[model samples]
Target: MDWMMLGIVLVLVFTVGFVFAPLGLGGGMLFVPILHYIAGWPISGELILTCLMLTGVVSWGSGLVHRREGLMDESIVKIALRGAIP
Candidate 1:
């Protein structure tokens, strides 16, 4: 990818990260589509894995912040993990 495209992708990623972080979302919904269409990347295992990693990081970061603020519910988190883990 060219420098210009890289710049555009970074800007979009930054925007998505800030917008979704507070909502406890990893922004995968936006990232995958943006990467595929804007970056012209093929949708494949690698792309999906990349998005998974990105989302995971965002989740961890946001979760930590919420936990620090005591805004996280332990029981709800466990329930959500049961469905999400598999």
Candidate 2:
């Protein structure tokens, strides 16, 4: 993998995170395409998996703050996690 392209993709993901996080979204929709098309990464499982992990991290960051502020409901979260995890 080209390190320079990877760095650019990371920066773009971080910047997109700011926009999407506010709306309670992960950057996967943008991330996968950015990595595949812009970064010239080939379409493969690893590319999609990378997008998944990156988006998961981005979403987790905002979720953490919301949880700390008690803006999240534990019961609903548990239900969602049950389905999501499986």
Candidate 3:
């Protein structure tokens, strides 16, 4: 719960988002491990929630660009969401 650590995590999340988002890799893969192992953040609800939110925002930003450029596939999204949503 250190503010400095939280700020660091947020910065890293934003950077990862910028780098990997266009490639369709949400930052979660890197975010979780980096936060847990490198940043020494605990594996807990707050960490998980923060990671998910940041990664999702990054993914959504990239997705919006792709969709606007006509590179997005509606059916593919539907299929993925169908499986991901429960």
Q: Evaluate model 2: give its TM-score.
A: 0.85
Please state the error at residue 75 of candidate 2 in Å. Answer: 1.5
Candidate 1: RMSD to truth: 1.6
lDDT per residue, candidate 3, 1-86, as tens digits? 58988888768777888999999998788988878976898999998997898788888899999999999889999999998896
Clashing pairs in 1: none
lDDT of 2 by residue, 1-86 (tens): 57888788778888999889867888779988898888888999999899999888889998998999999999999989888985
Give the clash total for candidate 1.
0
lDDT per model vs. reference: 0.90, 0.87, 0.86
Higher-TM-score candidate among 2 and 3? Answer: 2
Candidate 2: residue pairs that collide? none
Better of 1 and 3 by lDDT: 1
Off by over 4 Å in 3: 1-8, 37-39
How do the residues 1-86 of candidate 1 rate in per-residue lDDT, one tens digit apiece?
A: 99999999989987898889889878989999989999989999988998888888888889899999999999999999899886
Cα error, residue 73 of model 3, in Å, equals 1.7
Clashes of 3: 0
Clashes of each: 0, 0, 0
